[model samples]
Target chain A: MNKKEQRDHWLARPATVKRIWRVFVALLALTVLAQLAVSIKGYFGLDGWLGFGAAFGFLSCLVMVLFAKGLGYLLKRREDYYGGKEEPADDV
Target chain B: MMFEPIPPALALLLGGALIGILRGHARSAIVLLAPLATLWLVWQVPDGVALDIKFLDYRIEPLEGSPVRRLFATAFALMALVGGLFAYRQAKWHELAAAHIYAAGAIGVCFAGDLITLFIFWELMALFSTVVVWCGGGPAARAAGIRYVIMHLLGGVILKVGIEGIAVHTGSIDVQPMLASNFDAAMILIGILINAAAPPVSAWLSDSYPESSPTGSVFLSAFTTKTAVLALILLFPGEPLLIGIGLFMVMYGIIYALLENNIRRILAFSIVNQVGFMVCAVGIGTEMAINGAAAHAFAHIIYKALLFMSAGVVVYRTGLNRCSDVGGLFRTMPLTAICGIVGALAISGFPLTSGFTTKTLISQAAANEAMVLVYFLLAAASAGVFLHAGIKFPWFVFFQRDSGLRPKDAPWNMAAAMLVFAFLCVLLGVAPELLYRFLPYPVDYEAYAPDKVLFYLQLLLFSGLAFFLFLPLMRRTRTISLDADWLWRVLLSGVARGAYGALGWIGARLAKALMRIGNRLRAVAARHMSTSPDGRRSGVFARAWPIGTTALWIAILLTSYVFVYYL
Candidate 1:
């Protein structure tokens, strides 16, 4: 409806926003349904959970994110951590 | 014409020597063709030691051929070719030359038949790659390169010591797999892991690689660590300690990658992550696992280089590489975006990509060995790989909130190089048999069985969902996460700084005391005897003792001697 709204990505032009959201939701839903396709009886003490792989993947990511945030609190520093001269900012 | 059997490494090493003299089209053609010529020689190498010499009662072999060796050599040669193409137009002749020598060194390591030859090639790779890093030609590059060489030189000394011990103790220099139960083996393993960017020293890869010029980084990404991986596969495979080491590297890479803001550093971390799979596979030591390790290394160099090339293109155009400084670039740089996305998906191990085909074999081996913890951890790491590198890299650099930058797509040469590797990434995924044929063992595995595919899709896609849903958490910050390198870069420096301060303080206090002593002596001198500042002495006996004074001294010496004799 307004420029600021578009910038904020809320109340977008309905058709475009709806189409993208529909695809994202559909794809996520498809992953859940894929569990039905593959019967995953887990080994390695992670037994007895249906669709364990999906849950594990999702939960691991959440924990890692949370851990990274906690780690960032301690380890993250202003770019000057290495004396502010490092040029390329990415780390693997 | 000179007629000597040239080593395959010389094709690139010598070619590197000629690149500067050659101009324009000749340079590009030579750079592009040198790898092919080297690859051709690589294939011509016969099984077993190709060159041998006697050295102080030990046999040193410089070249050897085997499936695993050829596999590494082939990937290195191909990396050189594609990397050359990607970089030819952008990099100066010297950078390309150094890169060629660097690639040659990696290939040299792959074919090394003995510890001595391996060490030689290893040092060559070390020296030339440092040159490539220094070729960035700025203070950061210079400093990072210095630090890089320091790490490698330390590792090199440790490696040389290990090799010497192995030679003296084992009485053989052949590059055969060994256990880490002995001091020599343990030392060798540590030496190789340092180069592999394994824990406690893993930060060197992420620390130095990102500081190189965009093109230089692509070559830096390929050679040093993977050569170390190749060394592991050859010399230390099946050592169980590597399992723990590899797991540390895997988690370290993923976590650091998550916290990193620089794009290439993220890729550097992923290199450690990818190499972890190889290292862990080597620890498995079974035929399947070793093959998996070798195969994974082959696939990794291509995709990893592709990622670097894509990032290089970004830097080449925008002069910026941080996720914080870059976003929403896909609109104009569609080709780069697509290529980058392909590299990302391949790294994430999505179905129909090279990672899917290769990385699973490692986890499968873990499961086969009934290593419950290892299996589950590997699976989780695969998901983490996707999270840190797969979605995070492309999302921030390409599709996030528009930075309103319309940088052009990668130049044709770069685009072609990326396309070639991207094609290989998909090709290997779709038809893994092509690569499996190159493995040391026969292929009897299925990568795309329905159950397996379904499970992987579930794992990977859910991780992608997590990346998006946690978008707020993934926000870039103007910060760096401290890693193992901090021990040296920060703590060691800080310690040295403190030591210097203490030393300075002691020196200052000592100087003050000396000055006070000097002033007291001067006052005494002024009271008893005096001299002009110009050295016209007006003080008593300041110039010299007279003959009479000398005779008195002799009389005192005689009297003291007589008294001592009488006593």
Candidate 2:
């Protein structure tokens, strides 16, 4: 394909095409496997399992994201909600 | 030495003055030279008091040297140099000048041997740093600068009160590292944490910094909070409460950063997050932990400045700071993209980067002390840092679906400054010993073992993995998460407005009643006056009083007076 044609084709891929994302998932799986291959000393005895590193990292991130989302529901406000006529601070 | 060297702070103070007098290229020369001069002077002093004076039955030490002091002072001066280089081409003359003064104040605090001098320099930083914010030159900048100044000034007052309390109680004012347990110490701790952007009120950093000009944020990232870190190291080391406080800030930064849309605001939150590591280390209070805090700070200033410079380049070239607005600039602005990614990786503690070398020391300290929870939390925080800043920043700004932004890379000076700091990041990573020599304590540790590197990689990469997996959940929104500052920015203002409305209503009612009473008084006066307009009223009361009535009044007054006198 011509360069422009290829650019359009790349953009035309569906959001759920799951190609690049699949590679990332594969990497994650490989890493979790690698964590098992290595004999790593765990500071917290509970975190010394086969996939503990990967699980802990993933779960911690998941929890943080969820907690942050919860915070969003309670704390998030329209950009201009602080005052009458959007407060002209930090929007710069 | 043949003669006494000038105090290091003057290099910037006087150099900035020279910049004010000179213009154009000459001023730029001073901008670049001042920090280098300061760095040179930083190394000359021996580890003892350099200047001392007595004032009103008190001794003040303005310049003193120790390993920690030299470490912080050196890093600050280096930051001034790099930040100055990044700014001189784009910023106003006054912004550069004020920044020098701001940095000078920070340097002064580093060398302050007494609390009173520390307080003086602390307020000095608050003053000129606000001026730097004001140089941003917009309505938003103006308002943010005012809020920024108010927070710092209030912090300054709180610190002053604490200092006075300590002085009165102990009859001494020497600056010493101690736990923040007593009332005076607690106040000082709170005051310093306020400047550190510690929660539950860290929003000021995010609220004000992004408002600065692109270059201004670079300088903003370097001095104020880091100075607070230095102060904490000097004043409140080993305070257990800081562990909780620092961890809260760590989580707060990550969460808010994920929710933040503005590019600079995310970076601001990350600053709080990074400083939280130092705060935690201080609480650990071991020789290794203190060493870790000081080393981490040195490395952090460089990497953080580089990150801010990258974001600044984006804001400067595109005048767009929202993550959703710009991407895919690697085609043209390759240098900026690569440097920014390097910064992100370094901040993520990726192996072979400065963050890896420095941040691990703190975690190690936790482990050595057998604080399992602190260790785990620090590890998790390291992952979160990668998620919010390490990957998220570059992904959104440089590599996400092309916003078709093909703006040129940063200007030569900005590029040069980034390159210098970026090189330092890797150099320190590859050769940790170079940085260790300057640390406050004797070094007996290694940062990069094979297992440690593996674990950090697994943690960070998995965090990245989770990031991409949960990408939908991390979508940017056009809103702000209400922080503790909301109490002042939103709730207090709302209350004030309500009070004002109530007062207006009461004022109107009061005016009406007063008018009614005034009208009645006018009516009575007319009835009593001889010059009444109504003829009947004049006949009844307003007519001239008869001499007999006047005599009766006089006789009654005289009789009462004479009876009182007799009694």
Candidate 3:
């Protein structure tokens, strides 16, 4: 198959969707477990140490989705961000 | 008896000439060996005056005895080795050749005991690295390279002026700590800050590095700013302006990296951010803070180069650099993915990374000093690091939604280089002593106490938490963030055009006025010359009679002179 057909086939595969879902769930579970661990650790008077971490991990994923575009804007350049012709000659 | 250390200047001169003579793989071999030899020589140098010379009636000491200088020189030499290895397979022979020369320049700066030697190597670095950037071999790379050269050359000129002024005033060229209170010292500070990618000119790092070839970026990231940090440490340690400058660079790097989309550009911005930490540490100027700066520079070179190498692998394999075009490569390129993540985690200052060991000392020092605002800003900047580079880079490049590209794993050499650095990052993190011993200050800070590690993890993770909770607010992409350099690159370019246009208009008007005045003068002169006693020609000399009237006038003048003298 050509490149387009191959790409379409891959995208349409149920396995691909399932793998993506698995990743999402795994991330979620990891975040939740970390939060719980931090809280439990905090109960033993270690709140200053672990609480912020659990919270930050959860927050990073959330922010990745929320500010995905804004973050993307900051990091994104034109495909040829470094490419372009010199400015036109000025008559003046 | 007197002892002398191996002169770093000799190494640079010899290595640069040798590399110029070699070809292809031989060039890479020479480049790799040069730094190692320099490192060995640096170690062999005894703790005494190394080399001193007299130039232009001033005593120029180009090599001095100092543990701090030794540490920075060691790092630069190591950077050349690994950076050479990473670039060996793919880069052009000329690039490899020039890069070694560039590395030699950096080493020269690090080992420079005085300002004059530092200035010589400083311009050499600017020249050679611009060549490396131009090695990308495209219109964009060429244009950016020219702009890059112009900026650095301007910086070099400023530095030279500052050095000369200081020498004239102080009668010595010995490199010493300077406070930014007077013209000469302030000029030096401004000059050094420019190379450090300080605000107003910070855009050059991001603007040019991404234009470099994949391997080129790895080499590009290591030298320029770090050399400036070395200079700052040597010349302006404890100056308060550095504190503000460092903080500005830290936030500026993060915010811009957040908005940047190119994989390499984000890494480039993080270079600025990481250097900011060192600058701040230098400004603090305590033993702990200086030690932190030294250790952090050592760690940063390895990990940042690792991060760039992994990204280079991706770009090399698939020819994709934009985040929007890349995703989910973790499925196939697992090694690159893992290495990239390791680099990300290290940069984020995760518990078992090199950053954890080095970065903490600076914050701890600030806290000890009771500088509450600085402490808070640095903490927030640490969070911002996580939000921008740590999470943002890996997420978009490796773990975001699949873009369905099945590139092969990184080449064996690339993998080997990455693995070495990745292991080093962890090794340094876990065993800070290996690096601490090389620091200028004796190590007293503990990196692994339970309370400190736990506190750091919580602080960084909450920043991560903030990132996720506000993901909706961060959705924008594919745009360039404005930086202080925009004042010159964009806004000033516009202003320059307007000024030129106004000047042109005014010049045209002035020329026309002058021409009109000349025409009127000529008309009256012509009218008078043409008229005689009654509107006819008065004499031939007035209009067309040349020889006869000249003779008559000369005779009249001689007679008049004789008459006047007789009277």
Candidate 4:
């Protein structure tokens, strides 16, 4: 298959959709749970901000992964980041 | 407690030497026995008993006892045991020999009563560990071993200077907390930081670690960096710079790990990340935070070594270290895959794992201190841990689109090591008190309340969500991300080349000028020395005639002077 066809095939797969939905629900549930936990723990004289911290942490990771490609553009090197002759040209 | 006459440090050094002198299975036997003996000695030391000696009008306490020291000493002993088991089967005789010496160095550092002893053992650790790396036996391993030696030698020098300065200034060599404002303390902190794989020298870890023999990496992962963490907790707790430096390490490790394709390299970066939590905790410097750092180091050695063991097994069985070259091995190496996943989960700080039990105390300490920025950065780092190491490692190595290679499960010894650590990880997570009894602080910290568990589970599970949601961004294959060490390895190499080229250009010009001058001198000398029977300088005697005449005249003058004096 051509590159475009391969990309389209992957994006359109049912597994892809299922994976996306699973992640989303899991994230939402986690955020709500963290918020509740932090509030309750805070009331009991445990650290209060944990729930918010957890929620914030989860959100940021999502954002980072979402933008990882762009970030990779800046940070990623040729697979030959070491600039050695042994590095395969197409590996990256 | 009765004060022991024998020094633990001396015993360790002697044990290490004895192990090196032995051969075959005797080597492993000595390795195991030495640590057990050292552990016994460490446990026997009473609280507040210190071995004090006066030198150069300065008081030096080279041995001090506290719960913290005991905790670190215990971990080092545990590491020696497990690391010995993992390496005993596959390693060369010298690797086994060097491994004992290396473990001795670590144990010595734990019992080190003062900066002097600590520094001595610290350099010893560097020296012997380099020997372990060299045992991998390849050109790459050789080059890596050189770089590793250079980095550590530099660290040792800095530490020595710091120790001497503290001795001169304070008239005491006791290892105690020092403010970062003190130059001696700062020097010591930087020195230790370098060993801890903190930036900008962090590349030494990933560079040398993967190049080590599969068996050697297990030993490589345990000692040097974690010992540095132990030192930091003892000396630099509450230093604010550590907070920022550690946070940078956390994200840097995660990002680099995300970009890496080698299974072992991924684990190496994760070491930096795990140590970051300890460093941050030390910076917080609360009792709870210090407790967290100690607990985390204990848990980290077990889980991280387990992770490396799993990766080593894969590489050993299949002869591949790159993720692209490895996949579908779960079909055959199911046990290794499961253990690897367990390690990944524990490392990610999933609830009901050792990491969850230990890592949260540091985060809670930060939140309690109201360091919002640190709290956020650490939280983000937590998620990144899941992204790079948690999901990414297992997903690519074991479950990624099958590369259709099946290797047998790890050897029985390797399986035994992995299982032992995997069991410890869960056991500690589920029943933290087993490990808690060994912490530096009282066992008041709770790792698994409902709310806390729920919060972490949600955070990590969602982080996993983020990973899949951006699957397009997380594609893996063969690659390595350049880190700060690139400045030394790459940028410095380029600069050196530029300098060499400039020097070559200058040397060519200088050589041409010298050649012309030399020819002129040669012609002049030939004209004078030509043998035309009357040339200025013909034979060897002719050339020497002027010197001979001068000598004769001087002799006549001396005779005249003697005659005049007699008259």
Candidate with the greatest lDDT versus the true structure: 2
Tens digits of per-residue lDDT, candidate 2, B1-567, equal 566656899888998788889998899999989999899999987788888899998899888889999999999999999998889988988899999999999999999999999998899899999988888777878888899999999999889889999999999899987766688888898899999999777988998898888999999999999999999888888888888888888888898899998899999999999999999999888899999999999999999999999999988888887887887766677899889999999999999999999999999999989999899999999999999999999889987776866798889999999999999999999999999999988988877776677677778888998998899998887787788998988689989999999999999999999999999998777666656454544634556778999899999999999999999
Q: Write the per-residue lDDT of candidate 3 for residues A1-92, one digit (tens) a residue.
A: 45644554464456676896677556544544554444433222433443554554444444434453555545454443334732211110
Residue B555's lDDT in candidate 3: 100
> What ranges in model 1 sit over 4 Å off?
A1-14, A41-49, A88-92, B1-5, B515-567
| Model 2 misplaced stretches (Cα beyond 4 Å) | A1-38, A83-92, B530-536, B539-541, B545-567
Q: What C-alpha RMSD separates each model from the true structure?
A: 3.9, 2.8, 5.5, 5.7
Question: Interface RMSD (C-alpha) of each candidate?
Answer: 4.2, 3.3, 8.9, 6.0
Over B109-220, each residue of candidate 1 has an lDDT whose tens digit, in order, gives 9888899999999999999999998877777878888999999999999999899999899888889988888888888888898999998888888878888888999999
Score chain B of candidate 3 by TM-score: 0.90
Q: Estimate TM-scores for all models.
A: 0.92, 0.94, 0.84, 0.86
Collision pairs in model 1 = A89-B262, A90-B262, A90-B263, A90-B265, A91-B265, A91-B266, A92-B265, A92-B266, A92-B269, B530-B539
TM-score of chain A for candidate 1?
0.59
Highest TM-score against the true fold, candidate: 2
Which 10 consecutive positions of candidate 4 chain B have the poorest summed lDDT? B533-542
Model 1: residue B365 alpha-carbon error in angstroms: 0.4
DockQ ranking from best candidate downward: 2, 1, 4, 3
- Per-residue alpha-carbon lDDT of model 4 for B440-491, expressed as tens digits? 7776777777776666666787787677767767777555665777787878
**Which portions of model 4 show Cα errors greater than 4 Å?**
A1-55, A66-68, A78-92, B1-25, B50-62, B525-567
